[model samples]
Target: MQELSNRTSAFTDSVIRRMTRISDQYGAVNLSQGFPDFDPPKEILTRLAEVSMEGPHQYATTWGAQNFREALAHKQEHFSGMKINPNTEIVVTCGSTEAMMAAMMAITNPGDKVIIFSPFYENYGADTILSGAEPIYVPLIPPEFNFDANVLEAAFKQGAKALILCNPSNPCGKVFTRKELQIIADLAIKYDAYVITDEVYEHIVYEPYEHIYMATLPGMRERTITCSSLSKTYSITGWRLGYVIALERIIDRVKKVHDFLTVGAAAPLMEAAAVGLDFGDNYYKELQNHYTHMRNLFLKGLDDIGLKYITPQGAYYVMVDVSEFRCKNDIEFCEWLAKEVKVGAVPGSTFFKENVNHLIRLHFAKRDETLQLALDNLSEIHIKAKKR
Candidate 1:
């Protein structure tokens, strides 16, 4: 065969999804992928059932259905303290995955440099490559997952055209505080760069740690492209309902890119998820409580077993330290964990640009019984794989 495109050649299959398959193969309790094992909100499900028969089954507008976008605008404004125009400022996408990709395509030219934090969600790396942009990785130093402002400013000084911000960050579970976000906002303004955000866990944040929207920061609304989804918030990952919110000028470009990418998000799914977008603050409060309960249950189990892991302030994931196990390669260790320990986890290396391999990422987004099973399996790790 002729040579394939180099754009995709460097990409491996998603480590998260692969671990899910490994979990299935081994009958391990799957915590590697971050979807809930439970059903979505009953209100969303009920609306979906109604929409099934009422029928708008065909594609909606290239951007989104009018009602869905309006609901999204209302929801975002309610939380972010920024008013948004539903017509000109939003582009509904297949999911935040597409939202991020479309945002990259809209803003980036080949050979441009985009700043990405190390230990990021893996897709950000691929998105840069696919967009033909070179990535400048600024390490978010581990343990506390804080960045040195000087290091970050250096990346901006190097002519970075954009930066990807994942608040309530994945894999590491670091939620950027408002002060930290303000610093980033200042840097972005000083450098004349865009901030493309992945705020998928916006509503799933724990207490004492809040999700602050970059668009709401001073001098940032025009330069911030907010990519978020109903998947994580509504527990409807299969629905693939997500959107990009930016100033009208940026959103116009995103709409064109999004239109060519997927035509539009699913119509019936958008209608159903609008109900979720319209949900009151009480619903979000209850969501935080539920996730808090799950986090406590799973991490308490790890604590009881005498395992070491980072306690996340916001997101549902926890990074367990495996340095004591003496595993040279995190990938091999994760495979062994799946097969022998019967608990699947993502190798921490998959999410980092650095040579990090002493940690493994697991999520607690499952039901109580499911988490208990994974915890039971994990409790035997010392006996099964500990280096003598």
Candidate 2:
């Protein structure tokens, strides 16, 4: 038999999902994957129920249902102060995963180089490889997760076609400040590169930290492609509703790639989620407050146990330094954590291009009781390490 395509030979299964399975096998508190354990908003759930009974089960337009796109445009405009033409500038996708993939395929030639920050979400690596783009890694140095302008510009100087920006970045939870974004925007303009933004955690920011849209920066509206999802914001990960917002020309190409990829997002799900897109400012405020509570709760637990961790400015994740435990391999440490400590975590090495193995990421997007339980289990890490 002939062998399969060689492109995927280097690909390994997702470390996050693998940790989740290990967590299940050991009956550990599963915080390895970044999905909420709580229910979605009642309004969205009610609308979904109604849509299930009603019609529109057939595919909507390949781009998106008209109403869903319109509602999304309004919500985006309300937050970002940028006007979007729903019919021309939007492509609703299976999730932000597909949205990012579609945008990569739309913009990249086989040999194009893309810039990605180290300690990034693991999917970005796979996305670049699948799109046939070589990736240039720029380090977002730890402790504060700040990037050096020179390092970033050097990546662009090597002829990067685009840079993937994860505002409220995963693994570390560093929210880019306005001044930092301005620097990136200026470089993007100087280098003649596009910016593909992953803003799924846009509305989950904590106090004193804001999520500034990179597209809103000067000279960026045309070149920035924003990819986001209702998964994190609306607690609807299973719905698989997400989209790409960009200029008409970019969306035109992305639409074709997206169509050939998944055909269209689920019709009924899109129709129902339109209700969530129309939610007023109050809903967002409440969402932020809820996340803040969870963050404080989890962090306080870590503090009480004298564990060291970086406090997130936005997003639901916290990176705990595990160097004190004297572990050299984070993957094995995480496996032991799940089985012995009864808590799951993703090895930080999986998300970094650098040789990092002293940290592991834990998420707080769970019910209060669940968070408490995980915290209770995590407090025993020192004892577990001693036994090992």
Candidate 3:
């Protein structure tokens, strides 16, 4: 047998998914993966059932279905304050995962450098590597999860071809603010670099912290590539309907990359999810309220349990500090948490490019009962999770 590709030889199974398996094995309340344990919106579900019977069950088009794209464009315009040409500016993908991968492939060449913030979503690192590009990591300082403008400009000064921005970031759950995004937009413009934004949690922002579209920032519309999905907004993670919105010039390349990658997103799923795209502002307001309730419910339980964590501003994930447990490693502590505490979490080290192991990431995107149960199980952590 020939040698395996070095591009992926060093890869380990995703710590998040691996923890989910461990949680299942131990019958622990799984919070390792960030999906809701509740049902999607009733309207979307009803549409899905109807689409199942009267089917566009086969492929729609290489880019996307006309109705789906038009609906997405209308919805995007309603929120983003920008005109979008559904035919030329959008490429529907299997998911934001594919949307991101296709966008990276379209824009990067071997040896190109992409600036990625530290403690990023695990996939971004792999995406840069698989695109044959190098990553320049700039740390988003903890506790507040803010980055220094000077350090960021230093990363840009390294001739970075692009920057990956994950707003309402995963693992840490820090929402990038408008001023912060403007700093990024300025640097990107100064360096003539592309800004690839992952805004999946665009509608799940809590009060006082707004979700600003990076593309909406001054001088960014042309160079920004927006990759988002219906998964988080509509609670349809399995539907895998996502898309990339960019200038027609960039989207042309992305369309080719996406077409060869997955052909197109599922036609029936797209049709069903298109209903969600047309949802009025009230739907988003309710979504924010629902996630806000979940966040408060879960964090309040943590407060009662005397656990210290970084309060999330936008996303549903919280980084729980476990340095008091005196564990040898975060990975071991997480495993023990699943087996003994009966709750699942991902080691904070899995998401960091630096040496950070005193934290663990847990999500609150579940039913109130499910979150309460996890909290009930976690209440014993102080004693049960004590290091040997």
Candidate 4:
């Protein structure tokens, strides 16, 4: 066989998904992946069943269905306090994964450099590579998961064409405060670079850590390309319904890229998720409460097991310290943990650009019973998975 595409020659399959497979092979409680084991909202499921038979199984507009975009625009406007033009500013993609890719392709040239915070969601690395952009990683130092403005500004000084901001960040689960966001907004303005935000956890924030839209910051409305989805918010990960919201000019290019990429999100799914987007404030309030309960339950279990972890301020993920174990690396530790301890987790090293190897990420998005089971398995980590 001929040599494969050089651009992807060095690519490895996703570590997160790989751990999930290992978990299944061992019949371990699979907390490696972030998807919830519970059901989506019943109302959306009911609508989906209706749509399956009613029609619109064919593709909707290349951008999105009319009702979907309208609903999304209204929801976004309600939260961000910015007027959104559904007709021109939104292009629903396969998921936030594709939305990020489309936004990168639309804004960047092959050699352009993009800034990404370390301990980022894994896909951001792939998105940069696939878009043929060079990545300048700035570390969000652990424990508190805070970044140094000087380091960030230095990346911008190197002529970064854009920065990928994953607020309510994955792996570390640090929600960017308003001050931190203002600093980023200021740098983006000064550097004249675009800000591509992945705010998928916008509605899952815990108390005292609110999610602030980057586009809501002064001078950011035109420069921020918001990529988010209904997957996390509405628990419809399989639906693959996500969108990019930006100025008409940016979205015009994204629409072209999205059209060539996946054409459009599934029409029936879009119709169903539109019902979710139109949900009232009460729905969001209850959503936050439920996530908070799950977070508390899982954290309490970790505490009882004598495990140390960072408390997530927004997202459903928690990073637990495993340095007390004598493992050679986190990857091996996670494997042993799954097989011997009967629980699964992603090696924290997989999410970092630095040489971080002493942490593993577990998610609390599962049902209460599932979390209990995982914790029960994890209680044995000190005994079974500890390397001698």
- The C-alpha TM-scores of every prediction are 0.98, 0.99, 0.99, 0.99
Colliding pairs, model 2: none
Q: Please, what is the whole-model Cα lDDT of each candidate in the order they appear?
A: 0.93, 0.95, 0.93, 0.93
Kindly list the per-residue Cα lDDT of model 2 for residues 1-388, writing each as its tens digit. 9998787899999999999999999999999999999999898889889988996899899999999999999999999999999999999999999999999999999999999999899999999999999999999998899999999999999999999999999989999999999999999999999999999999999989999999999999999999999899999999999999999999999999999999999999998899999999999999999999999999999999989999999999999999998898899999999999999999999999999999999999999999999999988889888998
Q: What is the lDDT of residue 296 in candidate 3?
A: 93
Candidate 3 accuracy as lDDT: 0.93
| Model 1 stretches with alpha carbons more than 4 Å out | 386-388
Best candidate according to lDDT: 2
Report the lDDT of model 4 for residue 138: 99
Considering summed lDDT, which 10 consecutive residues are worst modelled in model 3? 379-388
lDDT of 3 by residue, 173-271 (tens): 899988899999999999999999999998988989889899988899999999999999999998898899999999999999998888888999988
The TM-score of predicted model 1 comes to 0.98
lDDT of 1 at 329: 94
Q: Which candidate model has the greater TM-score, 1 or 2? A: 2
Off by over 4 Å in 3: none
lDDT of 2 at 236: 93
Q: Model 1, residue 97: what's the lDDT?
A: 97
lDDT per residue as tens, model 4, 1-388: 8987999988999999999999999999999999999999999989989988997899899999999999999999999999999999999999999999999999999999999999989999889999999999999987899999999999999999999999889878899999999999999999999999999999999998799999999999999999999999998888898999999999999999999999888998999889999999999999999999999999999999999999999989999988888556899889988889999999999999999888999999999999999998888877775453
What's the number of clashes in each of the models?
0, 0, 0, 0
Cα lDDT, model 4, residue 201: 95
